[model samples]
Target: MGKVAWVFPGQGSQVVGMGKAIAEADADARAVFDAADEALGFALSRLCFEGPEEELRLTVNTQPAILTTSAALLAVWKKAAPRPDFVAGHSLGEYSALVAAEALSFVDAVRIVRQRGAFMEEAVPAGRGGMAAVLGMEREALQAIVEAVSAEGDVVELANLNCPGQIVISGTREGVKKAAERAREAGARRVLELAVSGPFHSSLMKPAAERLAKVLVDVPLADARVPVVANVTARPVTQAAEIRRLLVEQVAAPVLWEDSVRTMLEAGVDTFVEIGPGTVLTGLIKKIDRRARCFNVHDPASLDKALAELA
Candidate 1:
């Protein structure tokens, strides 16, 4: 078998009842959810399993909820199959990857991400900032547009470099709108606004990053048992000090997801198993490297399928 890399999904991938099926079928998965509830001092699993859509979408709730679900699925995988050689995650999902790599405990990760989500939401006022995806544009072109627009308006920066032709920009609402228009004019095929409560992974989130830096000091981070590709640097971070620094910078830095995947591939990771609520990372990995094998374990059925394939 080829070297395996386990990936996790970030925000915007959460949905109601995401881990219910797995929880119902697997005692270990249910235990993971139960632990999250105890750690968060709330019914996060309830909200995840029985969301009103709006409530589950709240940043504070969504962040911990998704982390719980992903970690739960990862627990099932570890119990059932061979461990991955490497791990990576998008934005919020990076916490999940760290937990899986034994760099951080699952309970600590859940609590921190809950704070992370709350900090991000409170960083900028709701109506003041936004994010948009610019499709079919090269990174250099998008960077130029962001630079040109930032010169005229509030800070607009690249947030997520998801794949070859997809990049998400975040900033002040007006600045993002201007950047989107400029991107379209600069030959982008489409610029679609994203549905998010706050503008994340942009310079406008510096305040949040500053706050999260303090929180990082309290969380215990150990040397990663498995290499974890970082979001800001697109490189494997094993040292605890570097992990803390990159995680803080990641709040206001571009999520180098495409590059992260490429870096993992270069490091001998040919198969990717995404342990999360959705197949978002799996899809992006496939787009980044068609020859790379990818799989997602979201629920009971998917977990069974993945175990069978891996076994």
Candidate 2:
């Protein structure tokens, strides 16, 4: 039988009322949300279930909210489904993957992600940096443009290599703008600016990464029970020390999402279960290989569908 992998979604996958239904029906899931509230000393559940949209979108709030919601969903699903053989997550979702692998405590992961979001926002001034998605372009072609733009005194660089023909670049506003124009000139299908607080996954986030390293030092991270495909290296890592170091580096490094998916595929992961708020990762996995079976569990309905299918 092909091995199974559990993946998690990152920031853009979050939505208002994401975990409300599952949490309301499942005590285990509810407890996860409650734990987050106590850890953060606020009603993170309320913000997630009843979002004002603006507040929930804030980086500090979004990170913890997504982590808490993903954990809550996992609490419900793990009760019925078999444990994943391998685990991975996209960008901020890496913390969720660690929690799934028992590498990071859910409580600690939530708190750390909250702090991480704050540091990222503080790293670059508002409107100073941005990210944009470039479609219908090869990585090499777009990378060359990014390098050329940065060489002209801007700092744009590849951020998320999501899949073939789809990549995201991050850097200063002017740099991103220049790169976007150049990408268009290079025959990119489309270039859309991302609605993000800062230029994440870029060298501009070095300060944020440094602060995160110090915070991680005080946090307890155990070795994983399951191999976790890291975003920075696109390889499975089980050592706590190595995972900790990669977590710090991931802040300013490109998310090798496509590479990570390919690694899992080569390792016989034919089934991918995305246990989080949205189906973003599921779509990306399908894009990587149409033969891959993908399932998403965000609420009670999705949970039922995935459970029945997996069984």
Residue lDDT tens for model 2, 179-210: 99999988999999999999999999999999
Worst 10 residues of 2 by lDDT: 76-85
Residues 1-311, candidate 1, lDDT per residue (tens digit)? Answer: 67999999999899999999989998999999999999888889899999989999999889999999999888888887777888899999999999999999999999899999999999999889999999999999899888998997668999999999989999999999999988888899999999898889998899999999999998899999989999998988899999999999999999999999999988888989988988888888889999998888999888889888878
| Residue 58, candidate 1: alpha-carbon lDDT | 90
Candidate RMSDs in Å, in order, are 0.9, 0.6
Residue pair clashes in candidate 1:
none
Residue 61, candidate 2: alpha-carbon lDDT: 97
Q: Candidate 1: where is the Cα deviation over 4 Å? A: none
